[model samples]
Target chain A: MITSILRPPPIIARMAFFAVLLGAWEWASRMGMVSRFIAPPPSEVVPAIGLLYHDNELVTRFLRTFGQVFAASGIGAALGMIIGWWLHHNKNAGRAFTDWFAAIAAAPLVLLFPLFLVLFGRNASTIIAMGAVAVLPPIILKTKEGLDHVPPVLINVGRTFNLTRWQHIRLIMMPASLPTIFTGLRLGLVFALINVVGVEYLIGFGGMGLMIAELGDRFEVAGMYAAILFVVLCSACFFWFTARLETWLLQTR
Target chain B: MAVANEMISRVTLYRVSAALFLLALWEAAGASGLFFKGVLPSTWFIGKSLIRLSGDPVFWGHFSVTLFEILAGFGIGSLVGVIVGLALGMNRYSGQIFEPVIEYLAATPKVVFLPILLILFGIGVGSKISLAALSCFFPMTLSLAAGVRGMNPMFLRVGQTLNLSLMQRVRMIYLPALVPPISTGLRLGFGIATVGALLSEIKLSNKGLGHAAMQAYARFDIPTMMAILIVIFALAGLGNMLIGSIIRLPGPNTRRLTKDRT
Candidate 1:
């Protein structure tokens, strides 16, 4: 209520703005104000999307990248949750390891891909390994946060009822921490996707990222733009899904 | 014993032991040669490579080039981000209107645009610096806008009551409120800026530590690669410390926030 606007503006305004933007881009490209090789504009980019669809290459690569992101993020988030929970329970010993994790997290994990490539080879496994590592810290941090949010009173109540450790987590701690853990999941997924695409581009392998790289190398600027657009759309979809999921969970509670 | 003394000893005892244990384990494993091929370079080898690289001026040149790119990119990107963010955040209508565009841009994995940047700026330092700026711009813009929008309403009302002019209001109220988020933005932006520069360097450029590392990898120079990785880790930590100093100056007005929340 405190942040409510003076009045809701017309949604058409945004559409109009975008239209103007596209028009400007089209003009710039036509007038040779911006190079076609660099930007390609919407006029060329529009046809580029059609070409991608016609080729049927987009779907396969997208699915492959999606699978990698899902698998890697799943592994990272699960490991992070268990380790984080264990660390919180173990107290000081856990603190020592966590400090190291924190430092690792702060570094750009994408830069550590060479070692991963050596270990896992120049395939999907290397990318997956890097993605999992990159996403681990946030999940661990959020898992600990989830545990911290569980009230002492609630834990004591569980103690009175003689709940096992797993039951304590599954019932009381889970409900308390689900929101935070979900936040970690969303964050982890973002990093996983990022690392997946980065590795794909670096290794010149399957995925939209590789397609973009290939298109650029071939001097097919419009197709490259289309591939980049696909990535952006996927990212937006991720944000939308996570937001909706968060709201749904909160509402049910 | 005093609480402070006990806290220090406890933390130091645990931390130092943990570090030593890990190092000894790594050394033993490397010595044993039981790891995946040559992936696990010995700690002794890494030390030798580090010393060898330090003596070479060419190695320092690569490090300096990357550092320069980061600094320049961060400086420009943050300046532009603040201006755009402040303009958009001046009112609710603007924020709503451009919200989708901003969201889409933020979601896009900025490094994917390396190819586009390469075409636009060529294979020189230009592309890397520009890419760093582009990547750095988003975090700063988001944080700055959030900072502006989240300013205490009470302060605005007080400004109106005092009939302060636009400049006066901005200086007295907005600037103070902006400090914390701007600092956060600066830190986050710098981190991404470094990532951006190093990434592009690795992707294509013929210079920088990223290039050095990649060159080593290409030749199967494990020890040199390990040495480069250590330097990168050290630099990342050092950058954070330096940026922490920058944020300390105009810190958040937590005292005011506490009063408001209560």
Candidate 2:
């Protein structure tokens, strides 16, 4: 066993850990140690991906969710940057309201979905707007924080070079703050996706969330898991895109 | 100093005006009868409902249910998180293997587990609590593990040199080192716990503030819904502030230690 060794390599340990977990899960499910309804074996779940694909809504739902995430994150990042920039530039406003944004970020802004539903009327707009608002606060908070923390030395150096305000901001402030802003954007995307899918599930809208909810309701356990797997894949793709973009952006500077 | 004080007052003026302007705009929108009738209730209407809600025993009953779920879930999740985080952080091989797994799980939208939890615990407080607990667990664990991993080795060495007992080392060394991460984890965990509980409640529940808000929405009782949302927001804010203040309670030595660790 890996445990008997003083120290197995991390890759070996990781693979072993997952293998053991999956094996135990399969064994337990087959033995009826866990209910089939709740814990369908991985063997069943793996094939269920084909089942959802054959239903033909899988790609459409995936695209629908992806579009909502993209639009919502764009809106949120734009608005958040503007607000955050304003707060950073105006010291007094930052003092007066930074905490408010922080507080809002901490609150479950997803709960405001009912209002969005009323305002946008049970459509894709409702989900998008809710996601955008849910994601706004973090981006705002991070933008301000990032801008505020631009090293004093860097600003002093720019001033010594007699750079114009616009040039200094564009050439110095923007690049200096890109990493933090990207961090905020990533965080905001996570929140936005969660809320978007959650709202879809709650309202049974036309997305993977709705698919998962519907499958669960029908007790199509494996299908529900497959839908969940697609959502996870979607999330992973988004995370990977941001991570690659962040790396590429940072590397250029 | 006087200039700073004047600037502070001016800032306060600006904040007040900004708030009032937004509230007035909301009132105008609500009264204009342009948008859907109940979408934007006037500030006055929300305020009246807030007052009514304050006096309503029924509101309190639902509020307490949500509150209990948040507290219980946060409590259990955080406790387990600290234990598991400490265990993983202490073990080199295990940390290398499992830290990525924990991070991956944490990043996934946890609400997707709602159906499974529902099937396991049914559509009651149990399912909601499980959701909240599940949400809290990841952040708390990640934060604590990071904290433990980052702790200065010299502190452990010093405790050993002093021949400190296990309890004394825990109280004087480990506890101080862990406080900042614990507070951060608490803040993050509690926030998500509230979201999980309320969301699960909204989706399916017999009695809770989330359920009440959904009921009001279904009835087109916009004022009541807004009032409930305000209460939820306030509770979350209060929770964050409480965690903030709790971390600040330790005296200078521990405070310095926290700063140093971070």
Candidate 3:
């Protein structure tokens, strides 16, 4: 089976692979081949998810976490693009900023949680700060790239048409930079979600992350597993939504 | 374009001046009490505290914990990621079967698994290292798979013609091609590794800079918190530079990858 997987797999390969995997996991747990406590079957986990959905404020917490991500991405993306555009137009500042972006990006934004905690206390505000700071760099960097790569001939034509700088930007720059900006925005969205959940987990705040943390603390293994699955599903939904948005924006072109 | 090149040439000076200017502004803001409730620390205070932390053996001990977590995590993750990436990239079928899993894991914030990691590995270095490894795995796998698939077909054809051994082909053709992505992933992994370890420590552990910072925060010791942050920043910067040097060290071919700005 492994050797067959190593070769060019057929369409059935993935379904077969997943079937074997799920079956093996369930079988192994039931037969005590692996620790059942750690590796519970999907049968238990799926039901636990439903139970939690009704028992706990799972859906509410899920939406709350989603709200934080959306809010952070909105604020961070806007600020990043604005700052990025300002810096790009000012080449000196852009150069200076780019030099430091590497160092800042290298450092984890989570380390500043102490300061953020001090400022905002144990709340969603701190989570938002964490997400924004993490999301900012990539957006700024990508926005700069987007603006920089605006085709030279396009700008030259704008000049030939006697268009002002702002006019050129409004007419040409924004549309041209949209794809790259969206790429940055997408990355920022992912990072925002990650850090939001992370901060939520850390602060033991009100969210799906907090639920997961609490479940783990209580040793509700199946519930924790369920929460994690929900988190993954939430992320997948976010990806799908953003991907659709990207295509929609492209269609406008 | 030429103007852009000229600006790039002057960036080093600009960066230094900007750093100095920001530091001076921050120092002034801090010293003048413009920053409320110890929101910022003066440069002098931060510097002195940084020096003090540098001398403290306890601080070094915690620093080592973070360092160990990143190294162990990056090393283990890199091995698994590279191998999986190699297999998946080499075979379209394997890629089909596993690539979605990789992509899904990549999108899902690996940090959400912290609870499971804590349960499985306990609230010590083990969990932190696990988190770092889990976090690093995605980037490593994705980049490596892309890198492997992106390898020059001509090189493989040449190897096939010569009927070179597998290991020889790997060394002569694959390893060199793989280095750039490996370094890219590691650099990315380094950032997340630092974040992961510090985050886990902050969440639970009693050791590491995160714990120290959190403790300092609880104590309202502003200077100490700032100092630890400086150290963390420096550690991250050093790791980034180190990974960058590694990418540069594998001769001119790899160096060009870095130079080719996206």
Worst 10 residues of 3 chain B by lDDT: B253-262
Q: What is the DockQ of each candidate?
A: 0.56, 0.67, 0.63
Sort every candidate by DockQ, greatest first.
2, 3, 1
Q: Best DockQ goes to which candidate? A: 2
Deviation of model 1 at B45, angstroms: 1.1
lDDT of 3 by residue, B100-163 (tens): 7787678777778888888789888999999888888888888888887877777788889999
* Between candidates 2 and 3, the DockQ winner: 2
- Error in Å for residue B27 of model 2: 0.8
lDDT of 2 by residue, A70-145 (tens): 8999999999999999999988899999988876777777878888888888889999998899778988998998
Single-chain TM-score of chain A, each candidate: 0.91, 0.89, 0.90
Please give, for residues B1-262, the per-residue lDDT of candidate 1 as tens digits: 5977877677678889978998998777766866675677878888999999999998999999988998888898988888778867776688778756776677667888888888888999999999889988888888878778877777888999999998898777776767777778887887788888888898898999999999999998888998998888688778877887866755455436322342
**TM-score computed on alpha carbons, candidate 2:** 0.93
On lDDT, the candidate that comes out on top is 2
User: In terms of TM-score, which candidate is strongest?
Assistant: 2
Second chain of candidate 3: TM-score?
A: 0.87
Measured with C-alpha atoms, the lDDT of residue B261 in candidate 3 is: 32
TM-score of each candidate structure, all chains considered together: 0.92, 0.93, 0.91
